[model samples]
Target: MQGQNGRGTDMPPAVSVRLEVIKRRSDFLKAARAQRRGMPGFLLQARRRASDEPDPSAIRVGFTCSRKVGNAVTRNRAKRRLRALAREILPQLGRPGWDYVLVGRPGATVTRDFAAMREDLIRALRRIHESPQ
Candidate 1:
């Protein structure tokens, strides 16, 4: 079977990425107050964890979609896309000891082309890292 890139799909890649997700609402709220970068498809919230925080070497991430995004199905779809974007980009680009959040837009998050969204995420991350605190 051919994959999306027209490659064979007999076996999966050997890479195993361990992604740590932020679960508590407090963590999300904390990220909300931190630096944010807006893109065509979504908003990125990121901050470095304090020295006293646990898992200093881990890259943690979170995803959120508000009711304005849509109903339950639409919101879930947006979150899923954000998760995919984070998984693909964060492992390589994310800074250790930082907590990152991906917030979905009303129309853009659900309707935007995925490749464009991927590029937006990459740019957003770069902006977040390069700008002063």
Candidate 2:
């Protein structure tokens, strides 16, 4: 499926549009813990390094897929899909000074609807943004 980017309907390569903001060592863990504190459907996880502090201006993101998801190829495909979802929806729901991490579920992310995946990420981000600070 395609997202409305105004002017016209466009399909940017998920890789081309994806922004890679590395997570620091400590911050990653903090958010992971924050996941437990999150309300329904807003848990967080880490896909990269953890930092001492969260980045004030970057929306840190991560991707993951367990062995159950599939073989290497399937895992990669799931990651690519999540990366694309983040690319399109992150900037919209993300706050200027927040971080985002995308964690993949075995079959949930890999076999799910791409459009629904897009909506899920959007809803998650919205929950994060609307959550208490």
Candidate 3:
């Protein structure tokens, strides 16, 4: 199949790329207090784990959508979009030993275009990495 860029050979394979999931509430809260970059669709919170932490080579991430986003169905939809965005962009661009939380924004998270949402995530990650701590 041809890629979105219209280059048949330029498309990447469907190989699964694995990334560690941040499941604990404390981890997400820690990342929340770290550096954050806000985009149109979501807020990207990133925290670089200390050298002494276990799994120093793993990149971990979390997804969340608040009630302000909508009802359960809408919030879940927003989280799903954020998850897809992370899956597509984080493996290559996210730095190891860092935890990232993608928090969905009200209205924008569900209404924004998918390609634009992807770009928002990419830009937010870039800003987070480039900014001085």
Candidate 4:
């Protein structure tokens, strides 16, 4: 049997971990001051939520692309790519009660190979976790 896009109907859909999007400007600022891991394709900023914060069980994430990345279309495309990368990687590697921000690089994020970007994420996460908090 064929599924929606011609894939086999028997194949189960991808299971992604629950995540909350960070919307407040303050939250992004907080992450900006917290731990950061720089990769070739993106910069990851992560911060552990304080005990006083709400949604202690939620994993929060945000995406941003500056004008330096390019025009509206280019920035949007970069954010989209960052979102896709986060969706695929964060579920398994992300820590609960933490916020993550993926900052798009000017030339790398939009042009880097996806597999290379994935590798970059893996390494970045490892470094972030290994560093002193």
Please name the candidate that would achieve the greatest lDDT relative to the true structure: 1
Q: After superposition, how far is residue 87 of candidate 3 from its true place, in Å?
A: 0.4
lDDT tens per residue, model 1, 34-129: 999999899999999998999898999999999999999999999999999888778767888999999999999999999789778878888899
Question: For model 2, how does the per-residue alpha-carbon lDDT over 1-133 read when each residue is reduced to its tens digit?
Answer: 3445551224332333235564475655555666422222223442322344454445567655568778999889877887777777665555544555666676677777776665566556555556565
Tens digit of lDDT per residue, candidate 4, span 1-133? Answer: 5655343332235456787899999999999999998888999999999989997878899999999999999999999999888887777678888899999999899999987887788678778888888
User: How much is 124 displaced in model 4, in angstroms?
Assistant: 0.9
Relative to the true structure, candidate 4 reaches a TM of 0.87
Every model's TM-score: 0.87, 0.67, 0.87, 0.87
Off by over 4 Å in 3: 1-17
Candidate 1: C-alpha lDDT: 0.87
Cα-based RMSD of candidate 3: 3.3
**Poorly placed runs, candidate 1 (over 4 Å):** 1-17
Per model, state how many residue pairs clash. 0, 12, 0, 0
Query: What is the lDDT for 53 in model 4?
Result: 100
The window of 10 residues in a row where model 3 has the poorest summed lDDT is 6-15
